[model samples]
Target chain A: MAVTLKEVAERAGVSRSAVSRTYTDGASVSPKTRKKVEKAAKELGYSPNALASSLTTGRTKLIGLISNNFHNPLFLEVFDLFTRRLQEKGLRPLLVNLTDETDPENSLRMLKQYSVDGVIVASSTLSPEFAKAFHDAKIPVVHSFGRFASAPDVHVVGVDNVECGRMAARTLLARGYKHIGFLGGPKGATSTIDRRAGFMEVMGQAKGIKVKESNAAAYSFEAGRTAMLKELKGTHAEAYFCGDDVMSIGALSAINSSGLSAPTDIGIIGLNDMEMAKWENIDLTTIRQPIKQIVDSSVELVMAALEDSNRHPEARLFSCQVIERGTLRPL
Target chain B: MAVTLKEVAERAGVSRSAVSRTYTDGASVSPKTRKKVEKAAKELGYSPNALASSLTTGRTKLIGLISNNFHNPLFLEVFDLFTRRLQEKGLRPLLVNLTDETDPENSLRMLKQYSVDGVIVASSTLSPEFAKAFHDAKIPVVHSFGRFASAPDVHVVGVDNVECGRMAARTLLARGYKHIGFLGGPKGATSTIDRRAGFMEVMGQAKGIKVKESNAAAYSFEAGRTAMLKELKGTHAEAYFCGDDVMSIGALSAINSSGLSAPTDIGIIGLNDMEMAKWENIDLTTIRQPIKQIVDSSVELVMAALEDSNRHPEARLFSCQVIERGTLRPL
Candidate 1:
């Protein structure tokens, strides 16, 4: 059985209020009384209940970490960074997996029931409406890796997908590829939409350049491989710019299975320089998304929001850069 | 502002007890009063606080999921299955990252403060003493992927690493490998010790067979690759049984960097046929650990412990088998 505060008070021969004051932060209590209470508590193995004390402090220090993509290997890095950083700040993460969930009502209900001090939606595929739900309910929220907006309804921290798309297009053009393809993730996803728009914007302006575009069912390996297999059946493009690194790996596998290889028969470039992209056998040349900076900025924004709920929602965008590897031909 | 039960009751023209009963499971409330309370709560956007109600129910429905290895990709699959399964049971997972932590007292104190109903230590590197700490403090715990004991002090759910090692030795011998090597994880980890013991037990009895053994600093890719790079400087064995798949992938990368390949220049087999092992580029033949079954059984055991805290601890060992792919030479 857990040791109760009352038992510690009895053991210390002090009133319950004195024992409470001894534990509460910055609460006034004489050093002698504190030493006595501390000795008794240690002897009794008594730890104050955070939930009971939360009733008075009105702060639970719990953050709801909401995400939808578990299949993507990139999320492993994201979770590791988020959990470790939150733990350092003395905040516990209540993980909520919304893999197949579309509605926000169930998650909101659960978050409120737990009385989470704030929420962080760490997904690029989830719509802006999802994070807005928490804000509408007066819950402090920050959306990490969310779509970039000039004036976001909630605090947003991530890269500009449209600019990333433009960068991918310019890189391919510089490599002297006449015909290229865009193998993107889900068509309706904001990341895919913005990336496609920017790719088309640049490709359309370039003289005598032909571009074909297709999308995978989801941002997963099987989906990317399946989509690439269908593309390879016909006369495919010389090289392609894949949606993300995981999809690029999948496409590389499909090429290998079809008795072809990268940069020799088909060149590919991907975004999101996840850990897997750096492996020797899977040497994928890709654009790097600064995940650590994004996560840290999101946490800081949420902490600021908790201090002042009326703080205006701000958008923070980090720049993306090309990480040169062997998947694409040398420039 | 959060809508209180008193405001909800006043709006519904009912008593505070009626509003509380309407939300509490199995509580007494008339249908008319329940309808009125629901309408008022919906109008006021009120959700009952689980933490506050936990005082009366004495159940938080929160389970602490503790882990240490975040660099391993296999953990992505493990966390995905665990969070989804726990959510299905209406239990929320409070993720605790113990990446660099050694002492269990800190975790025990934090877990006690939140009053989590139970804990599941899902790590092979963590010692049995870690889980026993929770058991000694009267907190129900189940150690998934933990080392097995004949009469375990806490509920244990995982595969038998020793049998897996023996199976690896037999499989390599069947392939007519005369010189074999054992590349194990950290020396002090229970899983590593047990697996090495079993592998040695089988190899020691074979005649005219040479076995060389070494251990990596960690199970991560960098450690595996660095260890293998050093091993390649000498006359390495024809085949190696790596501790796990991540290490196997690392070893493969190392082999490639040293201008070698698998099944031709060198052969390798690994444990935990993780998702990446099946990719066409990395068709690693490995022993499958039945991760989904292990996770399901661990959740069930913890739920049972929740119902009866005094229940006797049991060990559930699942068998593992080799999943043939392209890494090992055909037998």
Candidate 2:
């Protein structure tokens, strides 16, 4: 049987309430009584139950961290940063996978059942509707790597995808790539749509530059490869701005297999400079999303919401910059 | 204020106990009362609080999913499969990152405080002492991807690292590579030690089969690249069996940068045919550690342990197979 507070109290020659107070943070207890309780607890190897204590304070300090795209390597960094940051602030992360979930109600129900202090939805593909649903149910929510709107309905944190798209167009044009293509992620995703719009906006005004566009089924390597392979079999552009690094890597593979060299024959640029993008064999020129800043701000916003449920929702957008690597040709 | 059982009881015109019985699984309740409670709950959008109900059932249905390595791409697939499987069985994953942790006592105390139903340590490099610590504290735990002892102190589920090492050595020999090498992970890691032991045993019995051994600082790509770069600066073996796929990719990059090619200048075979290993760009010939089966079995074992805390610890070992790819020479 596990050691209880009552047993520790008896061993310490103090009241059970005194033992509880000693373990509780911010609870008043005499220094001598705390010393006695600590010694007894150490001897008994006793750990105060967070669950039992939560019942008294009505605060479990559990934060539901929901994500759908574990396929992207970028999320591994996000998970590492998130778990460490949450734990640093004395909160436990209850990870929820939404890969197969389409209905926001199911996630709302799940988080509600757990009585989470707040939630942080970490996904670019999952609609902002999911985050708004949680907020509607009176749960403090922060959406990280989510699309930013002029007037966000929920607390959103991520890069400005449309501006990144414009930046990609400007970079390729400045390099004197006359014919360009936009190889984007799935058509229905908000990021894909916004990026396509911004790319079209810049290309439309340039009379001499010709632009073409298509999309992969998903943001995965295989999908990008399959889409690019089909393009290679037809009329392909001289330069392309792929959706993300993984897709850019896949497109590079297709080009290499087709006996074409990067930058020399067909230049490429991607977004989200994930860890693999820096690998020597797959060095990619891409936009850095500033993941650490976004995640840190998301955590702070969620904590603030937990304190004041009525806190107004805010949009936290980080700037993206082009990271120079091997894939893009010199200006 | 959150809706309570009392509100549901009042709306349904039934006793509070009746409303609880209607919500509880396998609890006895009249069909009329159940219908009434369901209507009232749906109208209020009330979810039976899992934490509050856990107090009475003595089951939080929370499993502590612990890991230390998030940089490896293989973990993305692992996390996807683990979280989806756990959720399907009505268990929530409380993700605990032990990246900076060296002491098992801290982890033990943290999990104990949460009153989690079980814990799963998902790392091959972590010491067996960590798993045993949870077992000693009378918590149900399954060490996924952990080294298997002949007589396990705790439930272990993964491939036999030693056998995989032997298999790698034999594969290299069959390919007619007379000069072989073992490039293993950190020296002190149980997996690395076991792999090295088996590789040496196999090489020792083979006549005229020269073998060299070196250790990488970690299971990551950089460590493998650094170890191989140092070897490339001098005389190196004709073929090497890398401890894992990420290391093999690193080694391949090192060879490429040195103006050499895999399977031509130096053959390399790695373990754990992670998704990246199958990519056209990487195309690494490695031993496929059945991660899916190992993960499924680990979940089943942990669930069984939760049902019966006294369940004896057992080792579940899956077989590893050589996956033919571009990295190794043809037989």
- What is each predicted model's overall lDDT from 0 to 1? 0.93, 0.91
Please identify model 2 stretches exceeding 4 Å from their true place: none
Estimate, for each residue in A28-101, the C-alpha lDDT of model 1 and write its tens digit. Answer: 99999999999999999999988888777888989999999799999999999999999889899999999978
- Per-model tally of clashing residue pairs: 0, 0
Using alpha carbons, what is the TM-score of model 1? 0.98
Computed on C-alpha atoms, the DockQ of candidate 2 is 0.83
lDDT of 2 at B157: 98
Tell me the spans in candidate 1 whose CA falls farther than 4 Å from its real position: none
DockQ scores of all models, one per candidate: 0.85, 0.83
Error of 1 at A163 (Å): 1.1
Model 2 chain B poorest 10 in a row by lDDT: B49-58
- A41-128 in candidate 2: lDDT tens per residue? 9999998878877766878899999998888888999999999999889899999999998998887898888889899999888888
Candidate 2 global Cα RMSD = 1.1
Cα lDDT of candidate 1 equals 0.93
Model 2 / residue A149 / CA error / Å: 1.5
Clashing pairs in 1: none
Residue A116, model 2, lDDT: 90
What would you estimate as the lDDT of candidate 2?
0.91
CAPRI-wise, candidate 1 is: high
